[model samples]
Target: MNDLSRGLAYTFATGLLWGGVGVFYSKGTEKKESFYGFMFLSALLFFLLTWIFAFPQGAPVREVLLVAALMFPAGLSGQLGFWTMKKALEHGPHGIGWCIVQSSMICPFLAGVLFFGDSPSAGRIAGMSLIAASLLPLSAQGVPAVREDSCSGRFLLLIFAAFLLVGLQQTLSLVPSQCPTLSAAALSWRVPLVSLVGLGWLGPVLFRKTGVRCGEIGWISLLYALLVFLGQLGIYRAIDFLGKARSSGTAYPAACGMSILFFFVYCFFKRRERLSRRALAGIGLSMAGMFLLAIS
Candidate 1:
């Protein structure tokens, strides 16, 4: 296949893997499996993958340290984002949590424009506006009357927190790219180091008294790790191809948009989750916004 085809294929694969992550997380929560166990195994597997495949060869010590420093906050934010995402999914409608987190592309896009000297075009502005508008309808969707006041409020807060944390993680991911001293390979291996450090925080939680069984979540954790590794690889390859063609903008929004669509369909059919009219309208707007963002 040509470069464009390869890039698009990788992008779509990444989207599918990401959507699968959400699906598996939702399933795990339903089973009352420990998020800590899942995250720990996933981080460990990701670290092993980096050690085997992406480790930098004889890089200068200073450069290695610099990369580690840059990745630290990114890792922390990503871990926390995942935590909030799990909590949000546990309490709210599956589609709502997934959609809000996917919409976090806006965070990195704005960061690029304001901090990295990217052009702020009309298309991008309008796309951001549409995405912002969609949030109102999404948030307005009614919850079950049983716990409407408490559960609904908490769910919204958690999802919004997940969005910001994930967005910050994406924004931080951009920083390593701008560093002249860091090679892509060097940047890659250090990713798992920071991830391990982030996962370390949950180690204490794992030791706490809980009914969560490792046996129950073992396969789920392994699957989560495998999907994450493949997704990260797909994203790296997609960017390499698309960047050369000067169409890298298509990769992020395309993957995110596709993942959101995947979740909507998967939840509707597999879980029999029906969205209200306003929520459906919000999703439509969000998709349109992503399309505009991709083109911009």
Candidate 2:
């Protein structure tokens, strides 16, 4: 349809892909299927596919080379983030990890405003404050009110780190300003982050935990990879079809909303994670900020 509609659709789709990551890991039907393993493989596939599809029409050779070279960082980030995320999943409930990681959205929003000169509205600012406020209770350093196991502060820290990287990845979206024509430049800024997921292998390697079967895991990882590839492509297409402002306005907020919705429904029903008044308020506040940011 129109640019705004397209942007909104793409952004929402990205969130759906991102939010479903945990679901994919959960559906592995085997404890041996580590989230890190899935994340690492998925990211590698996504990046490779991105390169293939992006360059098929005779993209700039120099830019592609540079983009490929820069992919190292995105890979690195992904590896680390995935490790943290996987650990969080193992240590915490399914959807709670998603909520925790999302707590760091402020990082990118700030960066966007500072580096990209994207101004947030007053409503957005207030919503952000509420989001930050909502998180205060979670910082108390105790086992979450309800869970399979006690969530340690260490896990919280890891989740926060994940959030930071996600934010950084979003900020990396600004890399195109320096090298706009090179599709690689835009994608490269985040490739290392995805690559960081490889670090998860350390667990299986070091701890001697039984790893996922090669054949069984391949298809799952491939699906994840393909979804991620299409999601990023959609985002890039949104940026192309709709200018950054309108695109971000529609997409970012919609993505957050969708992810949050998934988290709430799944955590309450499937995983049965306990939700406190504070957590609900936080979710609301964060969503409000996201909506404001979109309109802003």
Candidate 3:
């Protein structure tokens, strides 16, 4: 298949995998303890396994520590956002939850410009416009009523925060590609592992133990870890085939958009949430903005 086709295919597959993530996270809520507990344990195990292969033979302790340190922020933000997202999903409409959670992308883009001096282009401008267009309606008025027990206002904040974290993660993406000495996989694993371990240390001291004891929860966590790993693999593969432009612009968002749409459709069909006329408009605009952002 051609580069475009391969990128498109990867995007679609990524969406499907993410769709499964929503379902899995929702199921996880039924378990007993806090979402972070499960996240921590699962992350720890995954990191342990990844480290076994990821740590180079006889690598310097200092270098290993440095890689681990890099992971701290990424993992903490991600897991925290995830826990918040899961809670929100349980109480909110799945479609809406997914849609809002992605607002995290905006922050990183802005950060890129500020920190890395990455300038925007016409396509980037148009794509960002589209994404912004999609959000206008959603934010114009009050959202549809969410469950009292669900994520609601706090959850929305978490989603926004999560997107920012994702943006930072994106900026960090330059490290591996630019450095060339550290492989992407090694960087990827280290980043997350650091964050998780940091959170595992901090979570309990700050808050009550939110441990969930459900056996099924373990399964969901495993699936989440695996999907994330696979998604990263797909990203690299797309980059190899399509280069950065296609991979970042068309490929990543296309996949993410489809994933977002899938949740929206599922929520609509299930009658879990009503898509306001405003939301529809916002979604369109958001897509435009995303396209603009990517190409820019």
Best by TM-score: 1
**lDDT values of the candidates?**
0.69, 0.56, 0.55
How far in Å is the alpha carbon of 77 misplaced in model 1? Answer: 1.0
lDDT of 2 by residue, 176-214 (tens): 433456663444434333334454555654465555455
- For candidate 3, write residues 158-225 as lDDT tens digits: 55665555555544443333333554445444434542453363365248755555464667777766
* Off by more than 4 A, model 1: 1-9, 142-151, 210-214, 237-251
**CA RMSD of all predictions:** 3.3, 4.5, 4.8
Task: Encode model 1's per-residue lDDT on 31-112: one tens digit a residue.
Answer: 5446566667667766677667756566667777777776787778888887888787767677667777877877766665
What TM-score number comes out for model 2?
Answer: 0.74
**Which window of 10 residues has the lowest lDDT sum in candidate 2?**
137-146
Stretches of candidate 2 above 4 Å error?
Answer: 1-5, 26-30, 33-56, 65-71, 130-149, 177-219, 239-243, 246-254
Better of 2 and 3 by TM-score: 2
